[model samples]
Target: MFGDLTGIMGKLKETQKKIEETKKRLDSVLIDESSSDGLLKITITANRQIKAVDIAPSLFEDREQLEDYLVITLNKAIEKATKVNEAELASVAKDGMPNIPGMDMFK
Candidate 1:
């Protein structure tokens, strides 16, 4: 029984190590999320850092148009970012838990 417990413990430790490693890999990686019907653009890192932001001249010409498109584009960008991040994370945890409880929000 003691030997079995040790084996289980070792497995758990390995799992935890894998999880930590995956998280570290994710942190080092970056996900670029941008939006702009060819106008406003942005690059976001995996850690949620804004790498770059650009705005086109035409984007400022029409305030209303810019605002509407900016909102839509930003929404789309954020959605894309979330999906990409989740997919990357999933790729790391291929054999572990699909969606850890309470950790769903992070994904």
Candidate 2:
């Protein structure tokens, strides 16, 4: 019984290490997405943090058009960030937990 507990503890420690490594990778991931017309740009981290936004100077005069493009670009950036984060997490899970069933569902 003591041996079994020790083995479980070892696995838990390994899992914790993997989780920390994966989090570091996620935090370092960066993605850039642009609007269809090339007027707006956004940079986001895999952990869904918005880092920067670049907008065309001409759009500054029209709040309505600027708002529309900002919404579209931000959505695309968020989607891209989410996909990257999911892929990274899935990779980590697969590497650390091969015994888990239905792991591909995370993809």
- Candidate 2: stretches off by over 4 Å: 98-107
Q: On a 0 to 100 scale, what is the lDDT of residue 43 in model 2?
A: 89
How well does each candidate superpose onto the true structure, as a TM-score? 0.60, 0.81
lDDT by residue for model 2 (1-107), tens? 68776775777678778877887888788899998888898989988889989999999999999999988888988898999888877777656653434545544
- Model 1 C-alpha lDDT versus the unseen true structure: 0.64
The TM-score of predicted model 2 comes to 0.81
Off by over 4 Å in 1: 32-36, 96-107
TM-score of structure candidate 1: 0.60
Candidate 1, position 99, lDDT: 36
lDDT of 1 by residue, 1-107 (tens): 68776775676577677867866665656555445346777665554456666778887889998887767766666666667667766665555533335655434
